[model samples]
Target: MKFNNKIVIVTGGARGIGASIVQHFINAGAIVHILDREFPDSFDVGGNDSVFRASGDVTNSDDVKSFIKGVVTKSGRIDSLVNNAGIIRDNMIWKMDESDFDAVIDVNLKGPWLMCKEIAPIMREQNNGRIVNIASRSWLGSAGQSNYSSSKGGIVSLTRVLALELGKNNITVNAVAPGLIDTPMTRSLPPEVFKKLENTIPTKKAGHPEDIAHAVAFLASDESKFINGQVIHVDGGKSIGANLH
Candidate 1:
């Protein structure tokens, strides 16, 4: 389970679940390349040399290309890619703005596509790679998350397609679908609403970012080579029909 000098790329790694995933790989001795819009003063790397931070927008093709090229030029290889960059523009379809929907789709879905497009060839050339996408349980269904849900649904499909396309090259593409995770984004919810959502989970409690990070790490590990085109729900049994009733 140790990466031991492996090169790992993580999008949206400045904070929250993405940050946790970055730290997990770093702790396992992997050199982590993090792409995020900003690293606030609070998010500290503590002078870690194994970490590379890139400030760029995932939705932009030029930015993605430059970032990947830089990583390749410096490291000469990319061992793994975690497409954890995403945005949530939750709202009922009628209430949602077109811009919000586009923004969500661009970041959550298109961003991953762009990243995969750029890295797929590198991995294929090396004949080895792992890709773990951070999808959402809401892809199953969420009342006020049409945009978010659609974007994640797209991720599920993308993972499967890539798995099929790259399996022969020793590349595996899989997804981690998280639910009720206690992140700053979830903490922004009103206490009552957050508690209500937490109660709906079969576990009756929220999960930590580490829970999802662990799943991502497992999927990115060599042991998961045979397992591809799959979506693992680290959702406290919520994907099995946990409900408010």
Candidate 2:
């Protein structure tokens, strides 16, 4: 109940880390609205009347504008916006297809950009808002994920830029860069590859979706009002630099 009567918007919240984020906000007493391309049949909004779900492509400007308008109409104001919608098209630069790169960049970078553009005016008018963008630790570097890495790196930059622009309006913009979290996406990796990744973590284990959600919830709360333009890595110290001994 930390966010009683608050209005929060989470994009790509139908499953995995996004889904976990929606649940956390809902549990914290926020009126949570989710925008996703599609909701799985098994996905549930916990029967919470405060929870709303809409299907739309985050990359579509028309779709993003419509969703924002709908949320404002129903909730009157938006207190927080979580840009959690992202997609990965992993490949070495040489092996990657142009279309794959375009698809990943469109959804991962462009989508968040569109969402922020639509929400900034609302937050500025209110003179208060929280924006938690879901970036990735891969922004640092990843061998087979050139497109994804670049897109996330762009998000990191975008978060910083928005923070500077929106600070005067009392809006805080931050990002949570998750490492190896156990989600459907990661679960798709071959067992050997997944296990290898887990072992590479400083903690010798992959993080859970809730771990990322916890960090996001903190960044989205009033307690973090003073914190802005920062990237919080919920990556089990994987971003701490390699172990050299």
Every model: Cα RMSD to truth: 0.9, 1.1
For model 1, name the residue pairs that clash: none
Q: Each prediction's TM-score against the native?
A: 0.98, 0.98
Score candidate 2 by lDDT.
Answer: 0.94
Instruction: Return the lDDT, model 2, position 30.
Output: 92
Runs of candidate 1 with Cα error greater than 4 angstroms are 242-245
**Candidate 2 residue-wise lDDT, 106-209, digit = tens:** 99999999999999999999999999999999999989999999999999999999999999999999999999999999998999999998888989999998
Residue range with the least summed lDDT across 10 consecutive positions in model 2: 236-245
| Model 1 Cα RMSD, 1 decimal | 0.9
What are the per-residue Cα lDDT tens digits for candidate 1 across 44-134?
7656889999999999999999999989987889999999988887778999999999999999999999999999999999999999999
